[model samples]
Target: MTTTERTAASYFLPSDEPLGLVFPDGAAADAPALPMPADDVLLRLYRGMVSGRRFDTQATALTKQGRLAVYPSARGQEACEIGAILALRPQDWLFPTYRDSMAVVARGVDPVEVLTLLRGDWHCGYDPYGANVAPQCTPLATNTLHAVGFAHAARAKGEDTVSLALLGDGATSEGDTHEALNFAAVWKAPVVFLVQNNGYAISVPLSKQTAAPSLAYKGVGYGMPSMLVDGNDAAVVHAAVEQAVARAAAGEGPTLIEAVTYRIESHTNADDATRYRERAEVEEWLERDPIARLKRYLTDHGLLTEQVQQEIDARAEDEASALRERMNVDTVLDPAELFEHVYAEPTAALRDQASELAAELEERA
Candidate 1:
């Protein structure tokens, strides 16, 4: 077997020691295999991180006000979201989980469109082909298969396309995740699996999810390399993902990246985080906030001034306001619209439901 096809026989855990490119103490700790980003790129990443946080905050507030049915806030995991998507080229595709709307936005999809599925309106808010982004999958790890298939097809067509599949730590436990990895490795598909290990899969802690040394280690069994990085450090996460993309593009198969981060909020608007985790744990993660950490690095190096910081914050605020304005408008639901995308032709069961719902609406009228 070639080196790329050599499966690791022993089960091992990912290194508990996380890789960090930039530290919270305002220093670049260690660079990854990929070269560090330029200062300007770093600033852009910081701005993106700030914008993602603002979007999450506003979306969470909207859920509370009944403007949205549900929101899985990525409040503390913005770095992982930004880094994974930012590393991809325009030709690359992204498959994100429902909680990773920020990644969809960062990939240049309309912010409002990214929220479409969560708004309870459509299958996806934007055109998947138009944006090269798959729907924000609500079911755990199912999108992994989609990503692998897309990447494999691209390779067969002699196209240099890589697919980045972003999933929550909880998703790592799903059976589809294993199937996707196994297939990708065997086929040498140009895909990257990014597991944002936010310490919990909803109410269940990582310890209860699996006994594997780390989610990253699961890649080794599939004959792929695995990386561990501090997900709160944007530069580190970005570099790690960038390297993985490069490897995939070179026909080096797949890489599994486990980003060590924390979820600072409840699983969703309807979840009570207090029931499962201690407030102290959340507070500790707050100190390592992605935005704050990146801001500190920029300021310490004289790359950002107070004026620049204010400007970035102002831009984020304006974007948030626009998103709120768009979401606040009431949606006009046509009872018939529900049956439109069920299939090419509606199934017998779906046709019956559509008729029943139409009759019920007509009676109210």
Candidate 2:
């Protein structure tokens, strides 16, 4: 109602099965066909998925080795993580959740800096404004409103900038998510919300998260357009995200996308998935693996050649090796650094507290 209205039908997805370009078996879907991406784009998507899965394994290994404090593996959710990044423009801002470490890395942030927070660092590793990506927010749904504010500011300044908020299904139920969606629609801010519905809010399943038909349907109440897409299909994820990004840039307010994905790994290194779920369930989702599905489709189309595969694998390995090497090295710690960023100008009381802490650390040293 703010502006840029669209046909009511366009706001709702035609099918409930989740719009998909490729089937689980690598076959293209029939009826109301979704267009496949260009060959090069598909290849790039494939490469990103492959490398992302490899990175997940490497990160998991780091956790076992005690190098990383913990890692939320995006092993099965690579499509959503990588596709969302590719859909974004360089000048656009991204507000990501902690689980979106992989997505942040895809946005060209340094891999090392991406893990600095998970490594138990005090401050967020990279500069949010500098990288154009907010810190990998650990608090649930807190950053969604930040995205809305940023997008609204950009629109007020008449800048052609958009904000993309990437969160999970669990976040849909938070008060901040509700406020963010409503305010964004009312302000007609150019922002896109990509909710990766990975079936669980920790150990709780989606059935407990919301009784709504689907997470995307949450958009209706906010007067935002929404889409439900198969998150395991990289092509569809990228295509859908691109469409949403286009709408935002066109001043169409916001779009809510509930990507139907699965959390292939447990909640984190600390959680034992088998405690609540069956191993067979995990095995079943494995067959629909995003990387394998995309690889099959590209190979059949003659897009992924043997040499290309080898080169991509080699590069991924090199990156993993470098990451492993760097993470293994112990970093020098400065106890006094914790006082930074609290205030532009330090309060006397705060200065005294910091001085006391510095003195304590000096004595310990």
Tens digits of per-residue lDDT, candidate 2, 1-365, equal 42334545554443566989888888776525446778898888988877787778988899898888988888789999998888888889999998888888878888888898888875788877776999888889989999999999988998988899999988988999999999999998999999999988889889988888889888888877788889999889888888888889998788888899999888999998888888898898898998889888888888889999999999899989999999899988877787788789989998999999988888888
lDDT per prediction? 0.88, 0.86
- Score residue 148 of candidate 2 by CA lDDT: 97
User: Any runs in candidate 2 off by more than 4 Å, and if so which?
Assistant: 1-14, 30-34
lDDT value for candidate 1? 0.88
Q: How many clashing residue pairs, candidate 1?
A: 1
For residue 8, model 2's alpha carbon misses the true position, in angstroms, by 3.0
Off by over 4 Å in 1: 1-16, 32-34
